[model samples]
Structures are given as structure tokens and as C-alpha cells.
Target: MDGQLPIDTRPWPVRRDAALHDQTMQQTIGVVTKRLANAKVTAYAAYPEANHWRQRAVEVKRQSIRQLEEHLATFTQQVESHGGKVHRATTAADAIQTILEVAQHHQVRSVIKTKSMVTEELELNRALENAGIAVRETDLGEYIIQLAHEKPSHILAPALHKNREQIHALFDQDALVYHTEPPASEDIVALTQYARRRLREEFLAADMGVTGGNFLVAETGTVVLITNEGNADMVTTLPRLLVSVVGVEKIVADWSGLIDVIQQPALSGVGQRLSSYTTLVSGTRGPDQWEGPDEWHVVLLDNGRTQLKDTPFEDVLSCIRCGACLNVCPVFRQVGGHAYGSVYPGPIGIVETPLLTNFEVLPELPSALCTLCHACGEACPMNIDLPGHIVQLRQMKQERHMNAIGVTRSYRWWARFWATPHGYRRSMRWARWGQWWFVRHGRIQSAPGLAGGWFKTRDMPPVASMTFHEWWDRTRGKRQ
Candidate 1:
């Protein structure tokens, strides 16, 4: 475990190319994503008025964002009134720094963590390990991936990239050290039980527990956590210091919106009406209270999120991290989440990457990455116009002078040629002539230059010898 390498943060194209060729990863991602997509469809089918509920959920988030400052102030005051501290983090570094300060203040030696994409974004686990603090992941999926030294491929199902055989192997290796004899069976429940027994010790020993906030209620200043594994509840309850480090965009005006919030993610992930656990906490355990954290900290992270408020990408903030966008995404279906080489992946990730990260470090990703199929937007329970955000980013990339001149020129020329009959016919003639050499069995399987590279991976439709109009007119003449 000491020699386990950190996650590879290579460029998207590099990771994408690798994902394209990795047969095992391809198979796992295809099966898991398909299963999730089918389940979500079936779930949505059962509820005829799902779209109506989604709209109301969108409105709740819209109203909260509109009065963000006021609500934030109210939430902050409420948290303090109940004895919890609110820390505002302006950036990823700021969030990590704040957590480190808290850890040092409490003399924390060990921390138990539940699944949190926000903390992953902050790279908090690595930071803690580097500082000689023992950090353990309590969520079963997270624990498996942590032992494997991998980042989550799916938001809800963190270990979606691994098969049962792989998980059995990982767990067997773990049990070998603890048990008198090696485990015999490859059952999922057995693996989960072993993991639970191991993590129980970590939970008791942990001085602090950190998890992500699903919905921060402005009216009550409550941090709402929804999870299936029940590890988050244990992590928050057992540890003396509990920290909810989450994105500020996760705010809603109050608890009234929770049903829609919980319902949307439930339909997408497990296709249930709601998740197994929905826990809301406003403050530490009081003298009147029984068992809870002695101290509560809610660190609200901005980190380029607040910048999206006035921008064209504002609707993206309404996302509940339901991950419905990933299941239906054509690209994600093939390459999986790791291919994006970022914490956020799939349609919404393509939109947020440039805005949240330094584009100079990453190539201005082609909007072609999205396939423009609009499946993501259709699946979104929040009614986030997801595909629209990708289009807006594509336009922004061009305006920022990030697009290559040759590619831009070629697209402009093609658009002009496509607009008129004469030009279209002339272009078709040229394309047919160019494609004649490559066409095999009525499809272009191979070509020269960029088209060759593209066709190497996918088949292209061969140009027709005659235009549709020309064929139709000839047939009409014969009929007459």
C-alpha cells in the first residue's frame, strides 16, 4: 500500500486514448453504465409526472441562487447560533488549508472520510497522508478504490470500474492479514462484511470525520447528507470533530426542496424513491442531545463555482451531482469517468473543466466531446440545460481565440457549401471523388490525413454518386 501510486492526472486526450484501447475497462464501463441507464429509464417510466417534480426542484435552486447572499448570511448565523463554525473557502487550496488548520488545532492523528467528490477535488486525502495523519475511507466503494489507489469512476458507485472478481481479490488480500485463514468465497455480502469489520476500528479511532454536503439548507443552516452505505452517518456521529466540506452551489432555501432533491438522484442511481439514508445536522451534540459530533464545521467552497453565477453556465450550479448525465452519455459509456482526467466528467464535466480549471494547462476540449446528442439534458432531473452549457463553452473557446485556425476555416467553408444547392452539389462531387479510393463495401473504413485517423476508429458514410434531389427528379420523370 505504501508503494501504491497516486491517481494519474494525465491530459484528457492521453487518458481517452488509453481508455479507448483498454478492453477490460471498456467492458466494465459499458455493462455498468448500461445497467444504470436502463434502471433510470424504468424508474422514470413508473413516475409519469417526474418532469413536473424536476421543474419545481429547478425552481428551488433558482430562488436560492437568486438570493444567495442573503441565504448564505442567514445560514451562517444559524450554524453559529447552534455552535457550529462556518468557514468560507474561496478556492480549492483555501479549502484544503482550512481543513489542515482545523486538523492541527484539534491535534487530529487519524481521520475517517466518507465518499466526497469535493474532498477529492481538494486532494485532501493525499494532503493528510503527506502530513503523517492516518486517513481511512469508510464508504465501501471508496474503501475498495482507496486500497486500489484509484479515483472514483462513478459518483454514486465509486468502484464501478471494478468487477466482482477484482473486488473479491482486493478484499481477499485485505482479509488475509486480519483473519486466521484467507477468505474462501467471492460473495459481495461477504466482502462488504469484511470491509465493515475492518473499518469499524478506524471509525472508533478517528479524531475527525469529513464528508460532502448534499444540500445545505439556508432556512435552517442544516447540512443534508444522503447516502446508501450508512458510512457517512457513522463517520459524522462517531468522530469528535465532523466536517462537511462541500461546494457552495449545493444550497437550497430550505428542507421543503429535499423531496425533489432526494427523488432525482434516487431515480438515477438506484431507481428508488429515495436513498437509504437522509441525515440533516445543524450543530454539534448539545447538553440536551445524546450521541453526535462534539464539534461541527461546514466549509463552503467557492473554487470557481461562484464565478459561474452571473455567467452563461449558471444553470450548471443547479446540479445535485445526481450523475444522471454520465449514464446516458455516449462518450462516458465508452471511455468511463477516468478518461476525462478530472474529478467532474461526462457532459457537465466538459462544460465545467475550462471554467473551474486553468484552460492553459488543459487543451480547449472540442464540443465534439459531447456528441451534441442532448441525452444528458434529457436525463437531468434538475432540468439543467446541460447540452446548452457545452454549446456555450464551445462558443466561448472560439471567442477566446482557442480554436485552431485550420479547423475553424474548414468548418466555415463546409457551412457555406452546405447552405446552397449549387455549392452542395459541387462539394458532393469533390467528396465522392476524394472518398472513391477509400470506400469499401459502401462505407469509408479508411482514408488519408485526419479523416484517416478518425475512420480508423469509426466507419464514415460514403458520399452518394447522385444527390437526393437528382434521384427524386429522375424517379418522378419515370413515373410521369
Candidate 2:
């Protein structure tokens, strides 16, 4: 709504601590992530050729990105040829303005939206609501969070952080406004029926339908929507006017390219062979077509995407929002998405957010959000080097002198001590003696200053009485 990514003002520690203390959210996230992760493992185990397909997808995405400008130009030409309009937006503000202008020209009073992470980046729903246009999220998870006034906690399951009881409470409050009876019980069927009854009317009445594209076929000017639910189908077909806001990075060269990566999101995200719906829209309705939007518009948003080209971080653009990495990330599983306090979350977010924002937003994400686990890289179908990127980001942060003076000094002192045998031995002896202050029963329970963070939730055994080097010399013969 404010035409900017919701970069949280709170420090990372504060946000992370809040998430850690929220037992309900933490439990919900853990359960869902484990289920999704297990599903993906089952899916891949059944399909031995998955790795091959994943590699092909990575190559297709890389080629498309290398030729992004050409693809965009061809895509725009084909869309226009098919009676669709394309608007290029260099920034989030530009995209919002273009969408608003389209809505204004069409006299659109209300809009229906499918799940769109890019639009979330643009804060599209809030912008439209501020302009007096009613907007409703039609995706089941999106709808729940929309009513609860919360940002999505997971990429695929927006309300994965919320349990059934919490949803019942939100739905009960919403029912009061509609003057409708609440569900007889907290049954999933009863809840879904109530939502369907409420949203079906909006689907029929909305003047415009907005969606985010999973892939854009440059060869045919087609926008692809893959979802587990049929909401995207309704959003595309029922409204008089249609607007799709997609990142430029989503463009693929042709149908062959689209196929290479089409199944990756579903397979890696929820372990399905395919989603329930795959909606493709090329343009406005033709005279022969009876059930399609009268007008179609595509907004190609750069929003700093082009800047990644020809850089080491270029592969970060290949992300398909599959959320596989989130499921495997230990930190994400424990703390969830909201703790990252960025539009994109999990491993890829730690790399992409700072890169896309030119390091002006969430600069500490690399250091705070990740544990350098390569699990995300293995889970990613796009082969993005998330851990590698995170390391580079930390280096970049240091080069920019973004770390606090005390922290920098501490690291330097530690590094200097570890760099030499004498210093290392002295430091080890000092640590063994100093740790006694916080030791409880044989483990160091806590410490003061920076080291305290590591001991906050977990304890460590005190340094061994003898170093490995000392033990080697005393027991086995010394190498020299």
C-alpha cells in the first residue's frame, strides 16, 4: 500500500526473539514444514529422474535470464499482436501506478486476486484499497490471512503459522459483519463452505481480476498460473478486466522452456505431480470466446531484477517460489517467515531481498537469518547457491563496514588468536578458566556479551582440559 517492501524497523534479534517465544506459531510451522518436507522426499524417491528434470529447468531458466531483454521484447510484441497490452514498470511505484491507471480506465470498482508474491512486494491490495477499490484475496490461505490482517508466514501456505482454532476465531468475527451465522463447529468442511459462500459472490461481482504469473511464455505471450486450488481459474475467467503483474525474471523463451520448469514448483513445494489447476491466458477474449475477460493487461515489473544480470547472484532470479527451501531450513522451520520481516522469506529471501533492494533493506538478513546450511541448495530445483550467496552477502556487509564496531572488533580479536598456535593455546586456556563463571554441572549454561547469544537456548560443554594437539602429543606420537 505504501509502494515499498515492508522492511521491518525492528532489529533482527528483536524480531527473531519474538518468533522464538511464540510457541503456537512455532509449533504450527514445525508441523507443516515437516509434513511438506516429507512429502517432497516421497515424491522424489518415487521419481528417480527428478534430478535430471531439475537440471534441465536450471539450464532453461539461466538461458532465459541471459536473454531476458530479447524475451521481454518478443513477449510484449506477441501480447500486443493478440490484443493484450503490456506495461513495463521499472519500480514498485511504477507498477502500482500502471495498475491503478488500468483500473481507472476500466471503471473497475472491485478486484479479485489470486495468490501473488510479487504483488505482495508491491503491496498491491493495500494500494488498491487506499484508492477506494475493493480487493479480495480468493486463495484459501490468502483469504484467511487477509481477514486476520496478517502477512503470510509461509510462501505456499500463507496461514501455515495459524492453527484451526485461530482461523475459527477470525471467521467468527468476520461472520458478524456479514450478518451470517458462524459455522456449527470448527470443522474444516464447515469453515470452507462458509468461505466459499462469501467469496463466490465476489468472484461474480468483481470488475477486475488480478493475479501473479508463475511463468510467462515469450514465444506465445502466455501467462501461466499454477495453483493447488481453482481460484486462479476463476480470477482469470470471470472478471471483465484482467491484470497480471509478473516479474521480468519469470519470462521464458517458449513452451519448451515453460515445460522444463512447470512441475518444479508443485513437485518441490508440496510433492504433487502437478497442481490442481494450470491457467494460461494469452490475451483478451476473442469474438468466438464466450468465457474470458474483455480486456487483458500484463505489467512487467523489474523492481531491481535487471540489476542481477551478469552478476554472481544472477541465479537467484530463477526461484519459482516453490518454498522447498523453507521446508528444509532449520531456522525457517523454527522461526517461520514473519521473523525474517521481508516480503520473501527463508533461504532465498536472505540472498534475494538484500540484492534486489541494493542492500538498503534488511542488510543484516544474511548474518541473522541463515546458518550456512546447504540444505536449501539441495532442496532448490533451480540450483540456486543460497548458502554461497549468503556467505558472499556477509562479506559484502563487512566490506561496507555495516557490522557494529564491538562485533567487528570481537571477530578480529578471535581471528587473530586462532591464526597462530601460541595465541590459540592461550585463548583456549583462558576460555577454559573464564567459562567457569557460567558453568553449571559440567556445561557452560550462559555467558556475558556476544557469546551469550549462542548459549541462550542451548548449553555447551566447557573446553576440554587438554587441546586436541596436546592430547595427540601426549597419547599418540606427534606428527612431526
Q: Supply candidate 1's per-residue lDDT for 396.
A: 76
lDDT (0-100) at residue 411 of candidate 2? Answer: 92
Every candidate's lDDT: 0.81, 0.91
Clashing pairs in model 1, backbone N/Cα/C closer than 3 A: none
In the range 326-424, model 1's lDDT, one tens digit per residue, is: 888898888888877667777877776776754533444446467889999888877788888778778878888787887788778889998998998
lDDT value for model 2: 0.91
Task: Provide the TM-score for each candidate, comma-separated.
Answer: 0.91, 0.95
Please give the TM-score that candidate 2 achieves against the real structure. Answer: 0.95
Instruction: State the RMSD for candidate 1.
Output: 4.1
Q: Which residue pairs show backbone clashes in model 2?
A: none
Report the backbone clash tally of model 1.
0
User: Could you give candidate 2's per-residue lDDT for residues 248-280 as a string of tens digits?
Assistant: 999999999899999999999999988989999
Q: Every model's Cα RMSD, please?
A: 4.1, 2.3
Candidate 1 local accuracy as lDDT?
Answer: 0.81
